[model samples]
Target: MARFRLLADEHQARSPLRQLWREFARQHSAVAGLALFSAFFVLAIIAPLLTPHAPYLQNDNLLLLPPSWSELGLVQYPFGTDDLGRDMFSRFLVGTRYTFGIAVITVLGALIAGLLLGTLAGMSRGVKSSVFNHILDLALTIPSLLLAIIIVAILGPGLLNTIWAIMLALLPQFVHGVRNAIAEQLNQDYVIAYRLDGANNLQVFRRIILPNIWERLTVTATMALSTAILDIAALGFLGLGAQAPTAEWGAIIADSLDLIYVAPIGVALPGLLIFLAVLSVNLVGDGLRTAVKKRREN
Candidate 1:
């Protein structure tokens, strides 16, 4: 079996992505995490078509029903209903879209902003570098959640404002990490050789620095994705994000808290989703880091 697996891997090594997948699949936990995350993401994408009923529609007759597995469960209302008689299963499916969308948008926005700023800071000298360093230091002084709260407070509570706040709060981490990585690469022999070979700053950065730092940036971005999800959920839980009737994970959990005794699954389901999302992202990040380290050593 081992020999056949090795032969199969060698046969599939024609594509870089395939090779990376093989390496990544070696970690059982990472593969499991990826599967779980992908399943949720797919469910979120197709939620509108798959949801049994409108998430916001209320059915007073079915209020506080238990899950289908419970003795009190109804077949039509599989996951049960909220206090307001909204379908829990449908709302949960729809909520996945909101939660995943916010996390992806926030992380991508922060990553782009961080890349631009980090590159500038890393390439700058003397006063320019000093200024950026101080600014990053100031941003990093406060915790990300607190910073997000402050921004949200200033900007007023809303979904877009919450995303922007989370982006701002996460910006310093990417900037700092990327800046140091680029700075180190700048001093390397290849960079010096590129300069000696008459390569311009743009060429050097495009061909050399960017490729080398990509894996690190990917690792950072994956970890940041988890943080973004948590921050958005926190904001939603505190009434600063997504707002009411939006079917967001955190908001769902928050709204169901009052009915814990009557409908524990209402609270537990959303919370479980959040936990799984974070855990999957973290696992993928760890796997990427390990894979990158092994590749570098080889």
Candidate 2:
């Protein structure tokens, strides 16, 4: 009887997750976006094996060479070399690691921090909640990119500083979002019933609030991820994020600006990669929102 009950409990635990996956899979754009992002992640993991040359290795012989298919191109240099004779393809693969790594770190940091602070504010009485919301609103009044830039400037230029700056800039959005979502859930009839039935705050949050608000949280995280990627690239372009010799997508474009007339592909390739990453992320975010809405309606 004990073993059977455990099995039943496990199945019950898995049911909602399974249903969520089914709903998410029904969105074709989400699937495509997930697949493309997964490919980028896989390539990032196996970058050493895929890269023909080191990202920073200068090859004088291959300077300004176009892609392999182009006229006068070499097969060894699949995506050709930049003005500095470094392999574009290798840099791209390696850059994916940095770009994705920073974005993931900042997003997770902001999300976790936001969840904690938001919960506190949401569960608080009138005065505390008002104060928290006021602070958040003040932060939000400054555009995220501008706020990040200001923070980066104060901290000085570097990848680590950029991550911190971006994380801070993004925190207000998450906190505000989570707070409102939590507040709304708290006012729901089911939540009140749970509370009236002698459930503690933690119990109510875990069983009622979290399950209800997680879909919105997932969508917010996805959207923030895309924004982080774009901001990272933008900062790198402005010489405030990834520095010289770093195989970052934005830095690649920044370094290749001088070569635009001579080696147009160098600038074009990294820009294209940035565009695709943001687009895929946005598609996934939109798809998730749509899926969740449809699920709720059904």
Candidate 3:
């Protein structure tokens, strides 16, 4: 028997292919997530072109028209009409913008805030850093929904307020994650040598640690987007999302609570779209994580 074993180049080539196959498998798990979310995104972008009727318009005569392929004139709606006779298809199309918009903006704001706070915490090791960490811990300890609800209740319901509430709620998680990543990266030999060679902390963080650990931060931020989308949808469903007549998915679900039992698809369509958006973001997060890990291994 050999004293030591050698891992050959052939084995390494096979490892990448295995990683590729695993990636493909991950992609397959996320098909439904992609399809539903893509439909909503495309619909939102082309709302004016795709909408058959104004999302806010109502025709009493056609109220509650069930989805029927044959009843073309009487019930032409594919997803059916709501109690107010608003076209389910059109509102659903229009709702995508508010929900997706909240997710994107809130997550971005939180990520930026987190980056700043986390950088400060990672660089300082004194009383101030300890105090900031405790604050982060306190924020994380509170239930996210409770925090959001409180913010909304205090500020009153509206798009801008809701975005602010969500950004505040999401900031702590980002801060904690980035802080950990930066702290770990700071321990590396390169950073140690740079510090010894007269590079200041800011220069090291800005040019060295940040660039290297950005991949990990991006992974967390992508997942955070999915969370923000869900939070916004919940707010809308609870009467805190976009105000009435704006055609938000959550607001539509809040209105159709009763009809959900009657048509099943009444509340389900918007709810399903919300679910799909979160799911798609989650899938993308998973795929990216795996890709990043594989890259690191190679």
Tell me the tens digit of each residue's lDDT in model 3 across 1-298.
2423344544654574465445535666555555655775676577778877888889898878777653643445777787888888888877877888667878889999999988988888989999999988999998666788899999999888899999988888999998999989888999999999999988999889988877788789889888888888888888886788778888888888887777667688888778778888887778768777776676
lDDT for 173 (candidate 3): 90
TM-score of each: 0.93, 0.91, 0.85
Best by TM-score: 1
lDDT to native, each model? 0.89, 0.88, 0.80
Top lDDT hit: 1
- Candidate 2 stretches greater than 4 Å from native: 1-14
Residue 183, candidate 3: Cα error in Å is 0.8
Ranking by lDDT: 1, 2, 3
* lDDT, residue 208, candidate 3: 91
By TM-score rank, best first, the candidates go: 1, 2, 3
Give the C-alpha lDDT of model 1. 0.89
Q: What is the per-residue lDDT of model 2 for residues 45-90, given as tens digits with 9 covering 90 to 100?
A: 7777878788999977778888899988889888888877888888
Cα lDDT tens digits, model 1, 50-109, are 889899998888889888898989887889999888999999999888887778888999
Candidate 2: C-alpha RMSD to true structure equals: 3.7
